[model samples]
Target: MNPDDFSRVRSLWTHCGLPSRPNGRDSEQHIRRELSDNTASFLVAVDPDETLIGTVFATHDGRKGWINRLAVDPRWRRRGVAQALVAVAEAELRRNGIEIIGCLIEDGNDASEQLFVTLGYSRHDDIHYFTKRDRPDI
Candidate 1:
């Protein structure tokens, strides 16, 4: 994503009901960090008029690829926008020699879970997710 896309991306996330607390981790600072990382991948889908519709962020920790922040405009859901974003991100990761890619879906987010499953991602029950936030109060 380009530097100018930050406001539109943040708006898209808010419109899609994604959690993005102002001045928090999902703020512009974090987005800028991701965009500046040469090894990271960020994809944005826009309409012909250039309005943001979908987005996905992918990163590789040298071995496995991680996908997150997949969001689509409510008006454009189930129309393959999310899938296309994932495809491009995955392709980029593969080009960088990444073999295994994984995504985290919040519990009860059925649409997201099904989207990944339909794309051939298998659920792994053997592992658990953990977080260590520098500022938990946010």
Candidate 2:
């Protein structure tokens, strides 16, 4: 999404229990920079009234594509909003020539896991996700 959508996007993230911050990678400035860089896209789904109902961050490292920070408004959950978001994001990644798309679901998010599985993603319990961030907040 554009920088103009940052505030509502951040609110949606928080409402959906996704990570966002005043000090981390999700800042409007950082999002603006990433948008300008064009390596990633912060996509949002809005309703007829233009109220944002979902969001997903799609990015790729010239190989596998990644879907991250997916969030759907609680009011919209169990509807098709999340599936639509993922579909659009996957289409965008495919347009960029990405063949394999993946996402990480933290422990205890059974709903997300189920959603991905329903969307045709295989469940892999064989690998671990490792991250080395300079700070925890980021």
Candidate 3:
């Protein structure tokens, strides 16, 4: 995603009442730079007129693959944009030699969890996910 892509994504973000804009100019620039440099691969869904509608971001450590961002525009939901983006992202990540692909989603995001499960990812029962920063008292 580039600076120019914000307007399209912003509309989706605002319309969905989600905080879509990056926190700061520097932060925004950093993300775009990373995307352009392929430190991560960022994909955007655009309309026939070229208006951005949705986006996803993924990273690979040449080992484990992680997806950090995935959002679909309200106007484009139910049309398979999110699924297509995931498909492309997974293929690209796998091509990079990563085997396991995982996305960290809020426990309450049933939709996203469902999406991942339907794509053949099963929640690990053998391991627990712990976070250092998200502790409730933090």
- lDDT for each candidate structure: 0.87, 0.88, 0.73
The superposed Cα distance between candidate 1 and the true structure at residue 120, in angstroms, equals 0.4
Q: Which regions of candidate 2 fall more than 4 Å away from where they truly are?
A: none
Between which residue pairs do clashes occur in model 1? none
Tens digits of per-residue lDDT for model 3, 1-138: 666775666566566554343554224566667766654787788889887777887788777888766888777887888899999988889888878888876658888888888888888767778756532332
Ranking by lDDT: 2, 1, 3
Best by lDDT: 2
Sort order, TM-score high to low: 2, 1, 3
Q: Each model's TM-score?
A: 0.92, 0.94, 0.78
Give the TM-score comparing model 2 with the true structure, all chains together: 0.94
Clashes of each: 0, 1, 0
Q: Write the per-residue lDDT of candidate 2 for residues 1-75, one digit (tens) a residue.
A: 878898999888888888656687887777888888756977999989999989999988889999988999999
How well does candidate 2 score on lDDT at residue 132?
100
How displaced is residue 19 in candidate 2, in Å?
A: 2.6
- Per-residue lDDT over 38-120 for candidate 1, one digit per residue giving the tens place of the 0 to 100 score: 66888899999988899898898889998878899999887899989999999999999999999988899898889999999
Best-performing candidate as measured by TM-score: 2
Candidate 3, position 101, lDDT:
87
Provide the lowest-lDDT 10-residue window in model 2: 19-28
lDDT of 2: 0.88
Q: Model 3 — which ten-residue stretch has the worst lDDT?
A: 18-27
Better of 1 and 3 by TM-score: 1
- RMSD (Å) per prediction: 1.5, 1.2, 3.7
